[model samples]
Target: MENNKNIIPEKSGSKYDLLLKIEDIIKKEYSNTEGIVISKDGEMIYEKYFGESNENQKTHIASVTKSILSILIGIAIDKGFMEDENQKVMDFFKEYDFIDKNEIRDKITIKDLLTMTVPYTFEEYMEPLEDFTRSEDWIRYALESIDGNGEKGKFKYSTMSAHLLSAILTKASGMSAKEFANKYLFKPMDMEEINHNDTKEFSFDTLFGEKIEGWANDPMGISAGGFGLKLSTRDMAKIGELYLNNGEYKGKRIVSEEWIDKTLKENQNGYGYMWYLIYNAPIRMYCALGDGGNMICVIPDLNTVIAMTSSFMMNAKDRIGFVAEYILPALSN
Candidate 1:
């Protein structure tokens, strides 16, 4: 983590006034927001903290973790660790008895997981934490959920389906998802690993009266790919900037430009490989969104990246509005 200094020099007049107004909207209407940082042309331009957080503080980022996982998959492909995204998911888990002799389940591929087209009904995999803990094998449990007999490419967003990608990464690369991220993505970008501080905002109470970092792992110890990642707003911004820079950070290619292009390409439902796209008039954006309003947005036309951390669910539209209504209008062409 970098120093919590306000690196961007404050601009005078209307820009400053508009920033104050944006902060007010975050503090009042968006009751769950912790902080937001906006960067343009790869430099911090506007940043502010609210409630009990600071610029460097890390918190649970909910489903934004999926976007990070997708990045890792990209890196895995770039390094030749995994040859292609079309590799069959069942090929990685041949030992699992659940998929044994099951052709339909075996047909699931890495692209399916990336595109959120896992065959299982969404509700079937919504297993509670207690039940998940008691399950002996998470990979087998996830594989057995291939009940979607309808259209093969139908989009069905499933957190459990995303979680399987983490497990597959571990199997394909011989390292945990966290290890792969640290070595490839985090270390190169100068981001830290899971902050182990017990009192941090992302900690949660356990049945044993102990606290664990916001990261939730499956029974197999693979990090959950869909959600449960804790990252500071600044760290999250680096991710957006990395994509905005087309997979290069500081002249180092973290992921291939081709992968970045495919990720931003419009797919089903205006989504592309876990990234969401929006076209609002003159402003078009690609975003990494998590539950509870956490977002890391990239606006290529303006060359801007925005990251926000929020405390409540169902507040993404409002946060995105701040960008459309306030930030974009202030930017110079």
Candidate 2:
């Protein structure tokens, strides 16, 4: 299938010194964590890297790509490529016929997919990653797996399911997801240059090792929605900053403020267009968290944004723990 917090008390010290101590924690404990960037009030407060990683290297962010895709979906609506998230997901999949008419897959809307609440069968949610990734057509396989009866509103997270959003983007925009993202999202934010290649390289052997240009695509050239996005840790913070500033970058508006606001409004599942918006916590924040501790997090109460990247190592220490237990209280006024 597809991939993919607590708070701490206040502490005393210079904010910079406290962050330096946090870096020490990362060095000793979370050895695989590549980098961490923190910005407060649109200013870079701290940025540090560990191991062989540096500011220039772009690491695969796994499910952090889902949050980026959510931004693109909002842009699609903002620019009139699509109307709204309520639009039927089947609107974009007209070319493909349904595998089983008994299922309510067509009734599934874009919001359902965005919130990970699509009523997918247990098998679809738990399908082996190798099996799903090796399929001839990923989007088709995911659609065929949908067996939503009345279970539409319940959370059913799956990577293949999220990839369908990418497919929808391609069909709606007539451009590959990478092309659209590069033109609309990355360029506006002055993101790192994406090295574009159309060649198909779908081997797990090269998945984490190979540094992809721009974003990874399936055989059909559609960008992966749930994973396969590689971005610099600082560039990931730019995304958080963008949302923190209500979807505008620099002086121009990249995405509508309304879309950004709507994207942060959580459903009962605590999800807001692929973002995990935590309203009940002492530090009200939302995060685009991914495997191996990759994340883009926004703390609205503090007017802060944080981004982090780590190697694809199992047993990586928790990014949330670092933020809650040390970073937040360290930065507290």
Give the local distance difference test score of model 2: 0.80
Ten-residue segment with the worst summed lDDT in candidate 1? Answer: 201-210
| Residue-wise C-alpha lDDT for candidate 2, range 166-278, written one tens digit per residue | 99988888977788888898988899656675537677734444555557777777887788878999899999999899988887899999988888885677888888887
- Local distance difference test scores for all models: 0.75, 0.80
State which candidate has the highest TM-score: 2
Instruction: Count backbone overlaps in model 2.
Output: 1
Per-model root-mean-square deviation over C-alphas: 4.1, 5.2
Per-residue error for 236 in candidate 1, Å, reads 0.6
Record all residue pairs in model 1 with backbone atoms less than 3 Å apart, i.e. clashing: 32-311
Query: Model 2: residues >4 Å from true position, as ranges?
Result: 1-13, 123-127, 208-213
lDDT (tens digit, per residue) of candidate 1 on 102-130: 66676888988888877674454364444
